[model samples]
Target chain A: MENRTIKMTTPLTKEKIKDLNIGDIIELSGVIYTARDAAHNRIKENYENNRKQPIELEYQIIFYVGPTPAKPGKVIGSAAPTTSARMDKYVEMMLKQGITGMIGKGERADYVAELCREYGACYFLSIGGASAMIANQIKDVEVVAYEDLGTESIKRLKVEDLRLIVGIDSKGRTFQEEQVKKYKISK
Target chain B: MTRIMSTEDLIPVIAKLCMDACYHLSDNVIGALKAAYEKEESPYGRDTLKLLLDNAELASKEEMPVCHDTGMAVVMMEIGEQVSWVGKPLEEAVNDGVRKGYTEGYLRKSVYLDPLNRVNSGDNTPCVLHTEIVTGDKVKITVLPKGGGSENMGTFTNLVPADGVEGVKEFVLKSVLAAGGKACPPIVVGVGIGGTMDKTTLIAKKALLRPIGNRNPNQYYKELEEELLEEINKFGIGPLGMGGRVTALDVHIEYYPCHITSLPVAVNLQCHSVRQATIEL
Candidate 1:
């Protein structure tokens, strides 16, 4: 597929991502929230139990990450996307809570794709293991909630030109499925 | 006569190894990634490979971790049979080293205190240490910081003797395909054949320590490794499973004799950021 690079800003809405397709590269800017397994579980628990959430989720982007602690003079440490599949169970919950975009690495489950289509949400993939390079793109970070979770704390991050790929579009088409079909050698 | 060694002496060495392994991409992994970039057919795959290369360079230069998942410390120690330890217990020293390394180095503390409790250990402590008594007089220490993503993709199975080589190949391929982008493709595959079930899994993990492009000394296993590498890449999972020419950098197979009725096999995968460091003391 001939992929096109698009620049996007956070506080994304349905209109912003409705046209995004698999394989399109995105250079995203503005603010994003970081969460991983621990934070996700807590978020789900809070929502189900009618507890107050630490951060407002509506119209925001969530990046699945657990960054290293920054050294003496850095905005953040090696910050990169962790696997998204582990967060599959929480996808529908977050989307229902009004998160317009999710950024992570790897393929998601079939139900996640369906939920994205239903909720007009998009799943973006950052380069897995490209932590140092990704870290350079983050302009600022602050632990917004769950600080006791350590690396898994939910952090508010202001990023500049963070690179990402449209892994699964709002329409449920996935780059992984398309690429595998196109390239898998039938032997 | 046995040589007396102090457990305290290992603390600094192990600490440094942990930091060094996280910060620097091993030479072999870097070389393979460069080669993968050169040959990758997909634009997305090539771009991802380039980013990884740049990430490695920046990580080493800036003394930062290559990935956010600093990983659980898997320390393999080959202790000389003739050596006697003094000071604190060996495991205690190792844990201390891990604690100092993760805290001082600013790497992520990824280990949990208990499997069910789900609380962070806070120090990345109580690392998984595997020690073997060897004939040599010098102790060899190797630390492999195993990321949860690739480690989660590992699989083991016991096939009947009749299933043979083809079954092992099929199992490995299936595991890799199932892992897809999750394990972070362009991975290093480690296969262990024969031995008992537990031994097979252990050898499978140990097989990952072998340098990329290095083959097993045995002719048959070497050939199997070559064939597996070729086939896995053909799956077109590519650099980050976006599709391309290289899915796996190399395949290393380690085997041992097993009971006549058993054909046990295990597969372990290492992501592109293959972080391992070895030292002899």
Candidate 2:
């Protein structure tokens, strides 16, 4: 948990993710893919049925989000992280696909941290409900697949200086668990 | 003498309420967030609170939704007993307003046509509407756009009368802890005590509509609210559960008398982006 912010780019490697610790601040830039519950379900189904996935998952980052419709002249609408815990079941499946990074809000199941350690992946936390501020960091958006899914579609996002905190590191340490214990007062 | 009120007129007003509630968070919420920002002990938690305040300001200035999940429209209407309705059916008119508001306002369409089939309703129609007939000729409507993250974390349980207040407190603390960052803490906890099972959950959600600083009015309940708030903060769940001093902005309890055998309790958690609005005509 370093009190310093580190800058990182997309298509992250396991080596790059290995040293990152829970509670480290990150300024992430470059391409990431957005997928929420519906998109994940479709992705999993496609994998199960041996169909080609819409987006290549290897060495990629997945952000759990379902943004509102963009206004005229806007690239995207209020975009923020949905609860990550809801996507916990899909984590193992996603990690198996060679995903190195996961971003969203909330505390996840314990096994998610273990999976991160097992797969040498990292989980980042974005501030929940800070949609407008977070949306400002997104430079461009393209719906790469599942247009029928609307907001749940898998979109390629180009974000610049997107703020995030490491929720779980590759080592399996979780910031929420450590920090909550620190500040909790005995009854 | 009966006053004729047309349901047709409600569409535009409800539409505006929906947009306004989504775009601009109310003053009470803004104030509470600012206070939470000032008092938050954890640096990470404080920074999160600051971002939330900035997000609210940005969303209002741009006339965009404060959060992406614009939520299912929860409408509470108080209609005058002396009024007679004409024009479209009440439910249809309300859904029309929701559809218009979500579409025109550029908000997300989150509601599904059916739970099992899992098809998007597309227009965000078929709102959850609760109506009550009251004394005046005027009609009052409140639109609360409740996000899914917090709504999904809500809980309900029926306890034996012997369990009493201790049981209620224990249940509430457990619920909040279990919700953790998932419910998006620095949350407003709406606790419903007494009543039947369904009614308890309804009032629990309705309790969130109250101003953050306002107490339950009853001295005993007011004290309980204060106690719960203090205890919750002590849990260190903090903002977004990153951990800090102020886990909850407020605790509101709404209770009703129930049968002798049952003590039912429900808890509804509202995320920091509490968006709601009310109007009277």
RMSD for each model, in Å, please?
1.0, 0.9
Q: How far is candidate 1 from the true structure (C-alpha RMSD, Å)?
A: 1.0
Per-candidate iRMSD: 1.2, 1.4
Docking class of 2: medium
Candidate models: Cα lDDT each? 0.92, 0.93
Clashes of 2: 0
- What residue pairs clash in candidate 1, if any at all? none
Off by over 4 Å in 1: none
Q: Model 2 Cα displacement at B175 (Å)?
A: 0.8
lDDT of 2 by residue, A1-187 (tens): 3378999998799998899988889999999999999999999999899999998999999999999999999999999999998899999999999999999999999999999999999999999899988999999999999999999999999999999999999999999999999889998
Q: How large an RMSD does model 2 have?
A: 0.9
DockQ of each: 0.79, 0.77
Q: Model 1 chain B, poorest ten-residue lDDT window?
A: B236-245
